[model samples]
Target chain A: MQETRLDTARIRAARQAIDPVFLDTPLYRCEALEPGLGCAVSVKLETANPVRSFKGRGTELVASLLAGDGRNAVVCASAGNLGQALAWSGRARGLDVTVVASRSAPAAKLERIRAFGARLELVDGDFDLARERAAALARQEGIRLVEDSLDIETCEGAATIGLELADAAPTFDAVLIALGGGAMATGVGHVLKELAPGVEVICVQPLGAPAMTFSWRRRRVVTTDSTDTIADGVAGRRPIPAVLDDLLVVADDAVLVREESIIAGMRLLLEHAGLVAEPSAALGIAAILEDRDRFAGRHVVTIVCGGNVDLDAYHRWIGAAPAHRS
Target chain B: MQETRLDTARIRAARQAIDPVFLDTPLYRCEALEPGLGCAVSVKLETANPVRSFKGRGTELVASLLAGDGRNAVVCASAGNLGQALAWSGRARGLDVTVVASRSAPAAKLERIRAFGARLELVDGDFDLARERAAALARQEGIRLVEDSLDIETCEGAATIGLELADAAPTFDAVLIALGGGAMATGVGHVLKELAPGVEVICVQPLGAPAMTFSWRRRRVVTTDSTDTIADGVAGRRPIPAVLDDLLVVADDAVLVREESIIAGMRLLLEHAGLVAEPSAALGIAAILEDRDRFAGRHVVTIVCGGNVDLDAYHRWIGAAPAHRS
Candidate 1:
């Protein structure tokens, strides 16, 4: 995968696209968290949104752009929260949205997405197949696809989160994000590097699905033999070449956090921070906790990406004895 | 308990005396929540603090007042989250804080309070005895009492949350608070009424310990014979006379909510709102969901008081099946 260099102009456009409604959330310096991480840790609590995820920023911006063409129908394929976000954003603007998902998607999320007035297209296959089907449907209907990855506009929209982060807490030494399709990390990193030139952009992946990290190191698009992690949101089998290139070009560091760390991160965010972050959202913090020495005394920001986990799954995950990170 | 009859001046004084470190939280309208509540439901999300509970607001305010008198020693009696907040606030201000708690208090919370640099005074008896011992120690040492109930400074501190709600949100028809010692209700209600006269204040109590509700109905303080519920926060045997007086004067309604509703509320807040609120914080929402017809179309706000629940307790409660309210 060749690096796709991103410029400040694209980031600037993203900022304009996501102003007013998309807020610059608080860059809180967590004193308690700082000591443990051995760094002056500041969290960009992306979970503090009306939709409870940083995905809302991207979805809202994308929806606004799509609304301009007088085409009301939007389509997307998601594991859970992204679909809910698209439906919600579309509903807010009086637009119709269709979300395609596999049967493996969490029931609560499917119910919620439908409740947000989105028509559900259930695919017999998994997420990749669902994405392909949704793309085809969007093309057939000439509807706007709020695609999770491979869309420049969507990545630009996601980048606005980084723009907001830079504006809110400019003195960040490093920033962390969970890498799925690499849309969030690429977008956020592009904006942050342009705004704060020397700030380190860190991307975290679930150990079970460390495709982005491996791809970045190998300098080639490589898929894992099998992807298995509790953090389904950041679990992706195929690495988008363009998005991975963009992520590597801007990211200063990348790490893979274990499943146990993800659970611990979820508990910490919920118990100490009063945030109900999904497993994907907790990935960045989980990485930090796993290797605290690497981030000590540096003003760091991490995104709590989404909050769309099944309660039953969450109960089992947090309740069971944590699996040791081998 | 006779109504204290606080005028605008008293409420204003309360607001002024409280420290500004604890932010005036947002009062966002929950469009999703409006369906069941029958009214425009707004939630004052006090769990958005660094400490993730409304207790930070009151604790900071009380700590500031104690520090102003040059008293280094501060003492409070709490089950969990409150103790942590007090310890953190006390530590921040360079004051020594002593937290007295029973053995029933969660181990995690005790550890957290200690982590925050507070001395723990574990009692052999229950919460009531622990509180009594704390009060006695405070009196003996002449240390400032950062009491949750009955302290003028504490009530004043808690009142700032109300001021923020009135200033942030649209004028509401009613306000709901999960009542324990009546500090939160008294403080918040006092400000809401002063700012918006049309607003009616409502206090919600767990059926297991209906001290505030009982007192509101009987016009006198009543001690419960026995109390055991999922909501450990609002399990106080008796209401503080001083704050109860304020509740009587300002409150327009008091309702008892079932424990199941509290659990449901916690789950909803976590699932829908992406907030990890304790059962006490969920009480107001529980009341609204239990009798949605009462809240129809009227602008209503519920204070999410605290988020210091034990993980095991939270898992057990939220995992259970919903029960029909009596």
Candidate 2:
């Protein structure tokens, strides 16, 4: 499939547009992990964000852009953090947001969205089914569809994370971003390529959800039959075409990290960086840990994408990991 | 009791000085609880900080100040978040840190402090004994003593949190800070009073460890026979005189939040803010929930003081909350 490159200038403009709307999360150098990895590892602490996720960056930007012409209602489908971000951002602007999620979506997350004053729509189906229905309903009602992956604005918004990172740690040799709808990787990678062209941008995906990994290898978007992972935030079935193009243009490589690695990564993030990351958010760290040699002796920054795991899930996942993992 | 008015401008100046060093932790407004309370209750999420606590603010400021003249070693007597913060900050600036803790300090915390590159000294007695040893050792080794509360720099450093809160939510009618050595409550409250004179500053202490609370009420520092609480971070016997004066000038009231309330507060911070705060950090939230009417129709901000609770302690606390209580 043919692809179009996102202009670097446009990415910078997106940064300015989104800067005031979301938190400029800190970047901290991880000395404990650095020596072991043989790399100057820095963690982009997105968990410090209002919604406890980098999704706030994209969701707030998209919400602001969509609400520009007085639109006050938005709809989306998310299993966790995305819904919370949309709800909180919508509440901030006095806009109404409806989140459609499967019955299996953690009750804690559902409660969080409600806490932010967003209307909840319990779709009696899986996340993909809910997404499809949400898209259809949004089109019918003329309500802005804030689809996480399909929307160009969402990708542009997620890309601002890259801009902030590059500005904060301009000396990094490589940037690692967790793969979801490919929006974050595409957006961040695009900007980093322009700012520091020699720097490598690596996209990390859980082995269970290797849609992006498979798609990049096949050079086309592909669907997975079954992609089950604890990293629910990034467990998308297929990649978005626009984001795929951006990924192809900027991402140097894609790394598939195991579920155990993701869990270990979360534990390490908490222990060393004083940050909490959901399984999906820790994929970048997992990827690096899985193959430390690739990042050895290099200045690297890993994005801790989000923190929205339910207590039951968190206890089970974090507990399953052996102590002294860090 | 006579108390001197605080140097409000200096407190503001200290805040500005640490602005670049400390992460601007979010003030997340709880819109869901607002309807029930008839007030906007927000959390100053110190748990999102680089060291996973507001202790980072004080530690960063102290470390920056101490390292100014090429000094490299600093020592502290804390087994909780303060030790971890000082250790992390020490490593970041190429300084060495030693944390002295009682033999009773949790093994988990000792492990974390070591992981952050701090030398650990486990004294034979309780925390007070460990503190005494740390002070003597600091003098003998020519190491700077990063006193948690007694040091003027420590109070000034903690005051930045109040400045950040005022900047983030200037209209807040009341500010709730967890009472420790009275440093956090004193420093933060001092600034809040100066920034917004009408703002009521209330200090919350754990019922079991209420030395600061007792000191304020008695108009002099008082020692408890035995203090035990889940909030180990705020479990101190003595209140620094300077801190007591600051508290007298700015603190409108002091409340003792029950242990059960602290547990509930931790769960709420985790579930709502996606933050992992220790019991001490959640004291302010506990105070609000326990006495919801006190803040009705008012805009209130609570400083989540710190985040260094053992994972097991967190699990046990959150799991053990009685069904009737919640």
Largest TM-score belongs to which candidate? 2
Query: Against the unseen true structure, what C-alpha lDDT does each candidate score?
Result: 0.75, 0.75
Residue A281 lDDT, candidate 1, scale 0-100: 87
- The fraction of reference A/B contacts recovered in model 2 reads 0.12
lDDT of 2 by residue, B1-326 (tens): 23334455666666544635365666666554455446787777665444666777777777777778799999999856778888877887889999998777666677778888899998987667778999999999988887777777777778877778777655678888888887677777777776767788888999998888888888887887767888877887766776776677778999998888888887677655666778887887788889988777788887776676666556566662212210
Q: Of the native A-B interface contacts, what share survives in model 1?
A: 0.16
At residue A216, give the lDDT of candidate 2: 84
Minimal lDDT window, size 10, model 2 chain B: B317-326
The ten-residue window of minimal lDDT in model 1 chain B covers B317-326
Model 1's interface RMSD: 12.3
Q: For residues A1-326, what per-residue lDDT tens digits would candidate 1 score against the true structure?
A: 22355545665665665533345554565665655567776666665544556676677777878777677888998877788778878898889999999788778778878888899999986677788999899999988776686877667767877777777545678888788888888888887777776787888999899887899878889887667888878777778888777877788888888888998787667555656678998887898899887877677777877776676676565553322211
TM-score of each: 0.85, 0.88
